[model samples]
Target: MIRDALLFQLGYNATLVTLGAMLLGMAAGVGGTFLFLRKRALVSDAISHATLPGVGLAFMVMVAFGGDGRNLIGLLGGAAVSAALGLLGVAWLASRTRLAEDAAIGAVLSVFFGFGVVLLTMIQTMSAGQQAGLEGFLLGSTAGMLRSDAMIIAGAAALTLGLVLALRRPLTLAAFDPGFAASTGLNVARTDLAMMGLVLAVTVVGLKIVGLILIVALLIIPPVTARFWTERTDHVVVLSGVFGGGAAYLGAAFSAALPDLPTGPIIVLVGFAIFAVSLLLAPQRGVLSAVLRHRMFQRRVHLRQGLLALAQGQPIYEPLTLRLLRREGLALPDGVATPAGRARAGKALLDETRWQLVRQDPSFEAAAAHYDGLTPIETVLTVDQLDEIDQRLPQPHEVSRP
Candidate 1:
């Protein structure tokens, strides 16, 4: 099944559609990084929802002009224009009005999508709209995608990819620190608009593959997932593209094999699965790794504290000390610290001094003046005494050189 899906044995159409989906995913991933960085992720959602009316209106206009109502170029052109207008409206509402960015985005998204639904309804009632197949734009159906449609999507993807590579340095500067970028004579606003244009291109191309509704997932999930694995901007962008492309390819292949599944949702699900795995299993940043590191730190602290007690000649509970020594691998089966154990304990003591957790050359005589009863130095030291000891300790820089 895998071989058939990948090798075009399932059919040429399936192969073409899968390739188109991959291109769409790659472009969306790269463009989405800027959106993610700008904290404007929801703007893409708004833009996507806003495109629906354009699609419906385009279909209606085509029918009015006595042209094919399902013309891909005309519908996509409408989508791009409406999406851009939606973004402008969001920006205007945010800047000119008191509405917050989120509120503006939400308002534009809902109003545009509602208007689109109305237009779709109006089209459905028209005589020529019966065969429009416009509903595919709403939830996506790759079955209707032709070779020409795939070619157009490929072209848009190529353009988006090229723009991203050409503008990477400027885009990175703008995304991270627009104020600094502006100080350096970069037109932050123009750079932002260019990035948004790339996003619009990808969104427009992705509509036929994942539909507008799920296309935002292509822009969001992969980039976020890639973030878990790296800190560098370039690495994240590259990984995000790889993850997005892989998800699209696998999802399209699976949908092709099943013939009953929608490719858009499947692609989203596949991307989400990758995100889930990364969240749980990725190094350093993953949940499991973080938990393990926390546990290891706790155990090391316990062992170090036990070693400190031994170094200071303070009486420690034998079982606790033994346990710490065993865990640190510094004790034999007899539960006694060997020479190696003593060396490790000395290292722990040095670390404690470095961390300022313990004082060097603590004066027991000065500390005991505050306590009445005859208690061990560690036990008798009051909080005030400990504070004084901390103050009297040689500073890290003042300590004698080795």
Candidate 2:
């Protein structure tokens, strides 16, 4: 009967926790989609880690005010302050120094987290009468969440959603091409700040469920995975929310089932599992798409090679059969391989391969007659191109030049 009661309570609390986490994750997914597009995903990481100190400070303030150690208001107050300070520091560092965005993010994250650790340790030692509940903010004890917490999360989620809807146009335009956005009269800097602030808020909301250590997973993985399923940004945002929220719900449920397991890590792992599956199977941007594209490209390359040799009046592989050409998608209409087909296929292949090979050889010209076939009679890989390609090859996967 005790076990049954515990299970029932667990189920109820789990549902509440999942609801809170889903609200948080949905906001994160929507906001983070823009952040990822803006190439500011690392900023989300910085804010997530930086919020730790704010949480610690909030607890300290609550204790000073004679409030209990488990005050959710204190925790969130601290998180907001910490996140705000971290953002200011990042902005100041960028303005004062030549450091890049990633470097600035890393520096702020380390400084804030280190400070949080010290504050937490100090509070733990000094507050012997009341056991510090601040550590839960670091690892997220969703099982301990209450109705108040759910309400708070729901409010924040609503605010975040409203902000995203209001700023969608500016955010989208800025993310895709900021220069163009600026030209069209959007205040790129303001748009950036607004979007980042939304991300920070979402991060704090998630911190109570997933903690600072793994919150970036919530911000990045879902949106990235969703991108594979759709080309349209609106659909991507919606799908990303579903993916993130669903993962949060399932992860919270699983964590409730296993007493020894931590909720934060489980949530992160669940999110990653979704991302991995999407990466392999999503329609456009999945691993399977890349693999198929590569195979098709390779076939065209082989056909181009054959056509090039023919154009140069040089010898190709003895008895280059129609089957060989067909395998490369360079097959002629009949059994006989035509120069035109071979050339066309070869040209298409070169265009496709350029993405993966551009840095290696600037002078690697495709066939003039067929980008797939042969370059002009005198055109060949230049000496400089040969040297560049040689130097650029991956150390363990070097290809020899003809």
Candidate 3:
């Protein structure tokens, strides 16, 4: 077989890994889209790290029951137990302590992960060779995974995705406006519980690839990247699933290629890479788009500033510098208006900035004619300014300005 036949020769295993990863990614993308929007991104991190003890305990229980040490059922049991416990701990801390949600999540994460590490160490020392393979589960080794494990992952993903899809409307409303959802009798707490269940499933399925250390990234990043691509909830979910599925494949493939590399980090890196691209280049929310939009906005504002100055009869060569307007390409060479460019600029300003021309000079009849019988642009406000005002509103009333 050729050197790269690892991908080809292990076609069966490769298919399983790809399928499992796809399922896991799809589940994560669907649930995580809501989680990210809800600002509970770190909860996934908490659950992921806290699932360690669950895995260890599951393995120990399996041994007690005479099950195979490598059984996925036991592993899932452990992860689920620990995940529930972690959520409980997070909730208790938030309710009992002065610590907020983030603080509680961080606290539980550190404690649970620490306990897991200790338990892992104990298993390593006590079980010898039989337990040696268990260590791979801690960081995930996709190469060693069996077809059975992939089936379990895929099954869990399908169930989770189906449930979420079924309850999509309520979940979306609950995430965006809990009070509104509550007022509408949407069962906010039940919706939240369902979301947690989904998160739990995602954590368990993803355990084989990113393990505890990196699983949250898998859940959070793909949705975040996908968010940049669209503002519609359904579209976001679809795109997130696509990005997540592709990342899972690449992550698994890359790890399989470099035998020494852990699958979890590889998957995480793939997710992060996708997120970075979205953050930088996505049409509406990306860094490039934001920068371009801001530049365009600033230029419009500057042009309007120049017109306002000229409208006030400030000598263009005097108080206002010709070089500044020239640099902006807004002024004429002799400081008189470049009627065509200025009129074009004015029309653009009205459309772009929504500046209200309360009273138009009869001399500007040509431009004034454009707004006949229309409401003055003065009634409109910049989106940014609107956002600032919206921020002052109560939490429940904060409409999505998007």
Candidate 4:
């Protein structure tokens, strides 16, 4: 069943629904990248929550006007309007009042969500609302979705993604340095609005698949997961879209294959699963890589200290250092230095002497300031400088023997 769903052989409506879910996920992921970069992730939460009242009101108006209260386009249009108002309110409060952006987001999200719940309750008591299924918008329900509805969702998602792509360069510039972007003739305010507009489109379009609440997960998790794998913003946007699309596609297939499973929660779970894998396994930024790098550095430190000890004729007291020296064939089990160890030790001692002489020399002050004991002295000094420093050294017979 799972294989059939993945292969898109799961009947016409199911296939369309899955495809729609994937496009919506990609749109959410790519559009949300700028919001994530701008540190306004909470705004998505506010906008999503703010959408509820619009949906309830739109339903009420449709019923009052003798139209289908469950019309997808009308409901989504209402949601977009309400979400826009909520966004504007947040901006106004943050910019014109004493409240911080987060406080404004909290205010808008709570008030609008509370009003929406009230409207939903009122809707439940109405005769026409008994079988409305409006509650599905809160957590998304793709069960019995029609082919036309699926196509609408997929089309809207694609449009949103294209707009995000078209504005990528300007958005990227604004994201990193708004001041520089402004100086370079990019309207920072317009760029922010464009970003918010894209986010709003994703939020509205995703209502039927991921729902308002779970849509925030769609918008956020992909970008964060992508960030674990890259340092470049463009790369992050691309990876985020891929991750989001894959998660949604797989999640929808899983939901279709398994009975009594919901699409929204399943999609969210899949996104988090991707995040977990990236966090633990990404090459440069993952926890496993960090641990390996640390271990390598520790090994280098142990080997360096062991060599210096051998050169000084000191007893190897640290067990790990001694074991490391033995593993490298630089020492014996009895802590005695091997011939190769003695040779390495001489070079290590000489390097140490050169560093000390360079630090003590007034002429080498510039080079001496960069000394971090692990750096080779040769890299710090030119050949001429080394020769000059060497001239200040004592004769070979004057050097102490081990």
Best by TM-score: 4
Q: Which run of 10 residues does model 4 get worst, by summed lDDT?
A: 126-135
Residue 366 deviation, candidate 3, in Å?
Answer: 22
Candidate 1 lDDT score relative to the true structure: 0.82
User: Per-residue CA lDDT of candidate 1, range 179-199, in tens?
Assistant: 999999999999988988888
Candidate 2 TM-score, true structure as reference: 0.75
Clashing pairs in 3: 54-78, 210-264, 356-378
Top model number, lDDT: 4
TM-score of 1: 0.84
Ordered by TM-score, highest first, the candidates read 4, 1, 3, 2
Per-prediction TM-score: 0.84, 0.75, 0.80, 0.89
Ranking by lDDT: 4, 1, 2, 3
Model 1 clash pairs? none
Candidate 2, run of 10 with poorest lDDT: 369-378
Off by over 4 Å in 2: 1-11, 300-402
What are the clashing pairs of model 2?
A: 54-78, 346-371, 346-372, 347-371, 347-372, 367-374, 367-375
Tell me the deviation in Å of residue 183 in model 4. 0.7
TM-score of 3: 0.80
Residue 342 lDDT in model 1? 74
The lDDT of each candidate is 0.82, 0.76, 0.75, 0.92
3 versus 4: better TM-score goes to? 4
Candidate 4 per-residue lDDT, tens place, 255-288, comes to: 8888478788999999999999999999999999
RMSD of each: 8.9, 11.5, 10.5, 3.7
